[model samples]
Target: MTATDDAAAPPLDVLIAGGGYVGLSLALALKRGAPSLDVAVVDPAPAGAAARDGRASAIASAAREMLTALGVWSTLEPLAQPVEDMIVTDSRTRDPVRPVFLTFAREEGSAAPFAHMVPNGALVAALSDAADRAGVTRIAGSGVTDFETGTAFQRITLADGTTRRARLLVAADGAKSRLRALAGIQTVGWGYGQSGIVVTVKHERPHHGRAEEHFLPAGPFAILPLPDNRSSLVWTESTETADRLVAADPFTFAIELERRFGHHLGAITAEGTPRAYPLGLMIARRFVAPRFALCGDSAHAIHPVAGQGLNLGFKDAAALAESVVEAARLGSDPGSADALSRYERWRRFDTVQMGMVTDGLNRLFSNDSPALRIVRDVGLGLVDRLPGLKRRFIGAAADADPSAPRLLRGEAI
Candidate 1:
């Protein structure tokens, strides 16, 4: 239905220009935290489209808590696969045997596994359902084509010729966000000349919730466990090599996959079409513009080596929602410069920090320099033996930032 369906339709409090995880979560978070606020999500995809996404993500502990706070985790728990342990190794694809240089197992008193391997589809489905139940509007099969900023509200023109006026507009449209560009926000980043080949594989033996990250010379090759003896693979390689691998015949691809996967999982076969995505780091210079704000990949897109991309997006959702809801409750304009500045300040530093970490990691590990390899291996070995350091690292991965928004810390805004 159009926003003008009712004679007394109120202006939207927030208009999200994307319906992915970040956008959907933001809508739900706002609706739950400030029940009186009107929120709507605009996207070209129909509802449930995310459920068909074959890729899976490693949801960090803090992000999991945010989901739980939003009431989306219960629906996802049954389909989720906890990562009971993690093994990191540095080796060549042709090495006789990969030796683990670093290991992280669930400590007796640890809050939970560092993260959980969840299907992107399942996570999106849960978020969408929760948003619907929370009274957030989903304008599917259309996207925000253009928006005009005004003193009081931003008038958004959708692809379907409908107009929505909101106090604030958020661009969660992704790394190549059209809204970001329209707002004249430029990003600084470069391609790694690498592409990640993603696919799912069914193994003959159970993985037992073990996740492995093998730091091959090309890049990290991750095997994240899934339910039903299946695992998600993120295989990184040079762009040329990735193209060849993905285009190879099934038998040829399987042979190459088996070489890197090893025999520990017994026999394994591809479960779906293998896809390749280019690797890069893109950080928008500014996260906010007047009544507009950027979220998710629109704000910062980092390498997948640490698997924190999704988590960072979730953090943005939580932070922005809190900032807006708090402003509204205080009888202030949610889209005012002050509220938008708060969100930018809260998320920009953390996003930049994570971007640097992932970029440095990709450069350090995605290479064949013998000296560098030795230094990294030694470093990993040292961290492995240092209990205090290991725990601290795991805590950082699982815990929210010290200045994290309330929702991210499992508290209401």
Candidate 2:
């Protein structure tokens, strides 16, 4: 209930190294699922820092279910925008007409949309509030500087010169996770030579809940609908070009944006400062070692071609929470080899599968070869024409495997 400061604080059942969406969600789920477990989150950011995140993410249906189960969705629902339909197109930057090759629409009988676009700040705030309410300790302005495992627990040294112990040390840190590296977990990945320019735009007309992905020669440029008349752009380009565009004057940047964003939205204006993040594909060689485990981007970082990165992280939290809570309920070591092994087995394949799918998609479409373009366009057209196949694709995007955690199924753990 308070910021942890005592160096001799009793060992926590779970100590998360990052206080982002994944870490906070996992902590909230564990505390709510099993109140007796001692959980604490140590983040390097100062207190109340999550409210400043200027990005938004697509929360898939399964992730929404998990959030709702954790009692955080209600606080975020009013600010979220449900994606009603999506269209994919392949074309060059100056193409007058970008023909839609694939389309996915929300089914009539579905109770919820396939996904919703939520502001990163709002999601984090909601999760943090829920975490606090559930009695999870919040340690801000600090991070795990080093850690070592004993037979029963791990001793963690903090950047603030505090020492704490935990049965499980979860690395929900980002792609360049120091905890992951400190744990001796090697990653297999390479840079994409591209970067995604992320910014929010205010348009003259409403998007009507439609999302668009334009497959340009460099990469996929996504326009995701946000609440009101705003849309979030994940515009991809060569790393060099991306950096230049972000650094350009507003007038010049707007000119380039209008080239990619057509008259369909009438007129558009960038709402805030644009930032570019380099694209890459990274997956830890292993998800667990001794008392440590990886979660979220620490375990896998994929290209944003499919917009499944956040959902994958949410799934990781759900599966890990399920495994740990079940182990705790049985009076077994939640961080025992058996428990960690089960969590790894449940998530590693799914993480690898998503990584490869996004990687292949980026390779197949992020190019200018005429033959490859024709082949990919024809493939997209063929898939679009098959109603049953399209339905399955949509279902797969919204639903999870039958073996998913109870929280992901909108059930109590």
Candidate 3:
């Protein structure tokens, strides 16, 4: 259904708040899996805003498979840079030598790399375009202002005074989800007092598809490879320090960036304005309530130390869509308690496990304690030396779990 026809349209089966990659993908997945369902997405950002985003993300293999199954991966593959290998180092900012304690390399003749780095703009554009082609109604430039869940539907009010009812209202509206709060769903979380500075950097030399994560006193400084002679940086620091650095003059900022970025890339230059996002660990106390559910950042927000934030969101999208689509196929209400419970059950353990992992990693690595450093470094070294264990770790991150959603396993729902 097009936005033009929305006025006369029937109540939707699913109304997703937020049109980021997660929301868009979920809408597409639902429509593709069950075209009879009415799906729509609403976001405050104007249409085409995603095309201008300068940030990038690491798409795990499982996410790539889901995109492929949805027929969106081919369009995105050209803009993606496969991660050939990764090296992890632990050291202080000024340390002359940052020793690589752990390394993960793609095996020869491997079917695919574990992950690929793609720009945020490209990803969202592809997902949005595919969603449009899939007949998913997209209402941009408006957000859900208020919502009330009735016994049969969720009455959602838009900022523009538009009212729409949906059997299921999925809040993918991000970490500070207004819909989640409106649903009386509390979140268990705390600010880490750290902020991640994201910036794209151009380098004279190619990265050869290698990603790096350096554990510094402030936090993990990640250099994720992108296509061309560029890389995306996620530099974490104390909230106050991050704010100051982002406001620093270009020259001063570049100097400080170099202190952590190092000279390996050679003649690096910032490509866009640096932005800092406060980091935290947040998980909604309940992922569902009546005719309401939460996905993506609305459900759980984790540290980017492991670059799993977006992948986790994709996981939620796939899982939730699978549950809803299956219910619809069975002639049951897609938003029924059974369907919501299945989604929550399928996602809860994974969400909490990842949240704890990221939180623990941030605490263990984002400090200057001498004793802790030794222990973590030794642990990393031991894991690196064990090929079987390293492969298992890579498989886990790549979403190789056999019980994952059909879409994540490169199959249709």
Candidate 4:
């Protein structure tokens, strides 16, 4: 049926653009968190099967907590490899600081794993399942084309020409969010001088459930353990260098990687084609405008050095949903400017703080200055020895109580 036809249409309280991790997951969170609300997510069309050859994401502990709160942690648990510890070292240094270890099991003194390293496909699939269980209408192969505001609601037109009048129009459409543009939200961001190349590698030795970060002069090269003995690689470098390497022969690339990544994995062979993603930080000058709000990659895209980008997005989703739920209980329009502004206030400070931290770390560690080399190494060592200091950093990174949603708190949001 055409959009204007006098046909049955889904009544939605929230119309979200983009069906990627952020959009779909938040849909489930809202549906599960506020069962009475109508949450619908509109994507391009038909769910595409997970792509194994392309991209992958490192799911942190905090991210796992959110997913668990949504009630699908056990299903996802099988596909992930537990992160038992982490090793940080200088790319050119001969001996690393005996590897600083931090694991959920180690820190919490329980059988639970610290974090799970799952593929992007697995993560997306899990969110899709959650959406299904929550009865979120999946409007695939469609997107917001335009919208008109009527003081109380936003009349949205999708690419399929469907009309959706929603209390809130959320932009989870990714780094380049069309919905955000339509809402007139502005962003302040700049690109790093680097590009990140992500790939999977089969190492000769097992990764031992360990995540490793090599702080090289160009950027950070991360080797994260995955299910089985294989490891996921995130190698960052100058844009030009990254481009050349991604286009280089596999053997040539493997040799260069071994030199920088270290052969500790023993006779490592690279697999999968490399994808070079330009690094940057994009923070919306404002997270909400009028009847629309931003979440996930739509609102802020930051450097992945800390592997906190997705975690941050999940945090946004949980917080936004919680605010809306409470507002509804209090007999207020959850999508009002006032309601959304609260979300912006809660998230903006944290987002900006993390962006600055990651940017500064990228700049400070991605160099070979003599003074910096000594100072930074000492900084790394100092954190390693002080168990109290190490625990705080680990807890913070693991998503322990930092303006998170109840779902992020390992609770039902």
Each prediction's TM-score against the native? 0.97, 0.98, 0.98, 0.93
For all candidates, what are the clash counts?
A: 0, 0, 0, 5
For residue 389, model 3's alpha carbon misses the true position, in angstroms, by 0.9
> Which order, best to worst by lDDT?
2, 3, 1, 4
Q: After superposition, how far is residue 114 of candidate 1 from its true place, in Å?
A: 1.7
Give the number of the best model, judged by lDDT. Answer: 2
What lDDT is reached at residue 306 by model 3?
Answer: 85
lDDT of 1 by residue, 102-160 (tens): 99889898767878988898888888888889998878888889888888888888887
The parts of candidate 1 lying over 4 Å away from their true place are 1-9
lDDT of 2: 0.93
What shift in Å separates residue 2 of candidate 2 from its native position after superposition?
A: 1.8
Error of 4 at 354 (Å): 0.5
True lDDT of residue 82, candidate 2: 98
State the C-alpha lDDT per candidate: 0.90, 0.93, 0.92, 0.80
RMSD of 3: 1.2
Candidate 4 lDDT tens digits, 297-384: 9999998899898888888888888888778767788687777988999899999999999999998988889899788888888887
Q: Positional deviation of 125 in candidate 1, in angstroms?
A: 1.0
* Residue-level lDDT tens digits of model 2 in 225-340: 99889999999999999999999999999999999989898889999899999999999999999989999999999999889999999999999999999999999988999889
Candidate closer to the true structure by lDDT (higher is better), 3 or 4: 3
CA lDDT, candidate 1, residue 106: 90
Which candidate tops TM-score? 2
